[model samples]
Target: MEKYTGKSVLKGIAIGRIYWYRKQEYRVEKVETADSEAEKKRFADALETAKEQLSGLYEETLARVGEDHAMIFDIHKMLLEDGDYLDTVNGVLEEGFNAEYAVETAQNQFAELFASMEDEYMRARAADIRDVSKRVIRILAGIPEDGILADGPVIVAADDLTPSETVKMDKNKILAFVTAKGSSNSHTAILARSMNLPALVSTGISDWEAMDGKIGVVDGFGGEFLVEPEQELLDEMIHRKNQWVADLKALEQLKGKDNVTGDGRRIDVFANIGKVEDADGALEADAGGIGLFRSEFLYLGRDSFPTEEEQFISYKSVLEKMGDKKVVIRTLDIGADKKVDYFHLDEEDNPALGYRAIRICLDRPEIFMTQLRAIFRASAYGRVAIMFPMVVSVSEVKRIKEIVGQVKQDLSAEGHPMGEVELGIMVETPAAALISGDLAKEVDFFSIGTNDLTQYTLAVDRQNQKLEATCDTHHPAILELIRMTVENAHKEGIWAGICGELAADTDLTETFLSMGVDELSVSASSVLKVRKAVRDL
Candidate 1:
């Protein structure tokens, strides 16, 4: 099939052209030299509405164009805090260029700094930040966001895509997405995958000015986007589309049906939930239960820790939602890239390697105990399995057990019911995976959090977009660890489940089944896909 090749030199903003590509459109603007007040007025009007729309994104994730991600916010912070970025952009704007032009110059001025960074994730993050700045400048200069691509199933083109824009998109109109920026690890990938549309990332098509409404086919699995598709290729994709739709319909029948294998092995299919919205997927998909309710959201998106009563209310809602089914809730798996501005952790010289998870819980017993008290208090409504993250040693497991004991004592003293809460820990780190047999003897069950396990074992940072190629779940080392984890856990008479991206790896589900993983806890979207995978296995 013929591909669009001439857009290689044009940027999304420069030359009034978007290097045609397949990617997510965080927002679109044609950056060019505008020399009139009428243009400036148009820019101001767009900025006002853009800010209004972006205001909805001030939550913990700092989602949307404004909130935490607003380029103006970054400049304001820099200007207020005393730095070079704000000064540079201001100086450039004073030189008579439009806001977009000034912002582009400022972005270009930082190119050397970003290029020199050894950390791929940090560098990629800089690119995303610069790209965001261009959009903000365009809005401030009266450049309208490119309208929802020229109709039909449009492949929205952009230099990069943010998570919020990706989530809020009209999924019905977006058949697939291709991005010149962002990587597989970006939440854009997660959201797009959730939308169940095929997408390809990092195609780096920054110059396709004519790509709007142009026919393109994205082979998501192959990470390939073919533009100006040939008739033969179109026919083949049409065939594949029909087959996929038919298969999806068949998979839908599995919803609400028990996941007892043909051999009569009943493996509970549970949803790994983060937000209240996740419950919608769980209930709608008819999950057997909510397996891993990430409690981070309760403490996140706000300025401070939630009160115990507040936490209890959230926990109780989750349990009640599942009705009679089991819901395993992980208590406050904090730290890593997800941060709450108000809940300040001293910027550890090495945040990822320093006080996080059990380390933080141990140091701040009040924080951990309060969360536990809430979970114990909420256990009355339904089955609640309390899981811990990054548990590397049996001693850490024992410490958590002690906290549970203390919380039970405190709640019991208050005449509150302490429902039986099953205890578990994520076996993700190499140490934890290796000692799963011993740890399983102490804990009731084991959850294989492959995301971190892969990182800790391989020493690859998943957040780094540039080196995302290194973050391979299919690597033999990760697969071996998973196999070992399953073996060691069941040997101690405890069940093991997977809760990482690999949990739903249809390519490896049979491999995991062969290794004896008792269950699989996946995102709601993967429930049906993994169901199909399990059947194939």
Candidate 2:
């Protein structure tokens, strides 16, 4: 084992690796199964079972998280539609192949595409697609995902990783992650960083072939690794590891501390959550409360609208998480995302500007009404902050708020548990940025989703590989947007927070701190680094 010491990004930093595997799963079935109805039937059954198992997981997540998570299964559904995967496999099998042979040939095709991809997001998608393929093979061969995570401690290294893999990771035993193919924005990269697990990815520098278990220290943030580490190196890693734990202890002390800078400037730190239960982390982190509780999660994973009771139960769970802390919940922000499978929105020419966010809420007032009614009903239980997303106009805000007012009145008339809920908007577009001051007047606060703000402003999809270099956060326009929003929010006596990837970046923490952000709603892992940066600044 080699100890590597270098600046590491803190993507998925959690309580030191909870799960470890001494040996990595690298088995590949090499038999060539000929194309036949029997083969297709076997493959279809495997896929169907995977679908059912995944659906169960999906439903469970919805029950715990909310409907917003259902779209992932909708994606799963696409893989099953018309036996799309089966047909693709059959096409390969028709070329005179066995299961192993078919897997190899298709894998080669995928490898070529992965090689040809220029965008990091697109390249990372290859891994997810590969995971899907591998699972299909596993099903056909009767292998299971059982006990995979329980297999003891080792740094899981691969060419790349997917969200499914990272999200499924047993935080209980897994220690760390390393990959040769991914960069920061990849789903796994982001998830690992959020989990507070040390990871190193995009290591085009490391040799995956020769480096099986020799041992290497991974610094996730900056993507550094050392191989065949000496004793001195091991000591340093142990020291840093200890320092990391110590730093966590220190941040916990700041739980109730105001996010104040050296000059007495106060920045609010809130947790971005999807459901009410998600507020637990925010409260535990000693955050002011929830910054953005995307209510869409309630509507997303289920087949239809959640009954008012279901909505009430879900909202109540979050109120309990905060207890006395404030929770800013966003009413269903749908249009732009594939949040509802029934809607099946067509691939838009310009999704950033398409029918999404607050627009969708206004268009479908009933949908928004259910959530607002739930929030008001839950308001008696805890401090609730109500916000809307994709608000580029005052008219949209006015309409949506009016509906909320209606819901509150209706709930009150019905003798429901009604309470005061502050209204807010997500400042995620150039139009919204330009008029944030106006929006500030209408809403209680502004929560910036920079991922979309930057993309909409620059007219560049950050996910597109060709624009990766151009999709920088430091662009003058983006900084100015933050500056203006902060100023506007303050002018209105309303707080402003950032909930995008930028909120989690340690390097930029000082810059945002300097700019006068009221809150930072970032991943869990980033709390320490951001806290450290804030403490220093």
Give the range where candidate 1 is weakest over 10 consecutive residues by summed lDDT.
8-17
Q: For each candidate, what is the lDDT?
A: 0.67, 0.67
lDDT of 1 at 9: 13
Q: 1-537, model 2: which lDDT tens digit per residue?
A: 543333244622322322222223556655554545665567668767767767887788888888887667656545445354456567866655555446545655664576467664455445545555666667766655533444456667666654434544555455677665555565556556555567765655445556665666665544567665677866776677777778678777766665666767666666676544446666666666677676765666333456566787888888886778787777766663344655556677776578876766677777677777777888899898887777778888888877877887787798886667777888888888889888888888888988888888888876454567788888899989988998989998988889888887778877787777878988655554566567667
Deviating ranges (above 4 Å) for candidate 1 = 1-180, 194-197, 205-243, 256-266, 348-350, 465-472
- Candidate 1 lDDT over residue span 1-537, tens digit each: 434321111111110112233332243333444454544454445445444544433332365444545554444334222357556655654454555655556666675466457765445445544545555665564454543544455665666665434544565566666676666655556555544556566666655575654567665534556766678877776676677667667878987666655665556667787765667777776677787888876776443466677788888888888888888888777774455655577666666566788788887999998888888999987788989988889899898888889889988999998667789998889999888778979989988898888878888877666566677778898888888888887788888898887887778876777787888888776787777666644
Top TM-score prediction, candidate number? 2
Candidate 1 accuracy as lDDT: 0.67
Per-model TM-score on C-alpha atoms: 0.65, 0.67
The TM-score measured for candidate 1 stands at 0.65
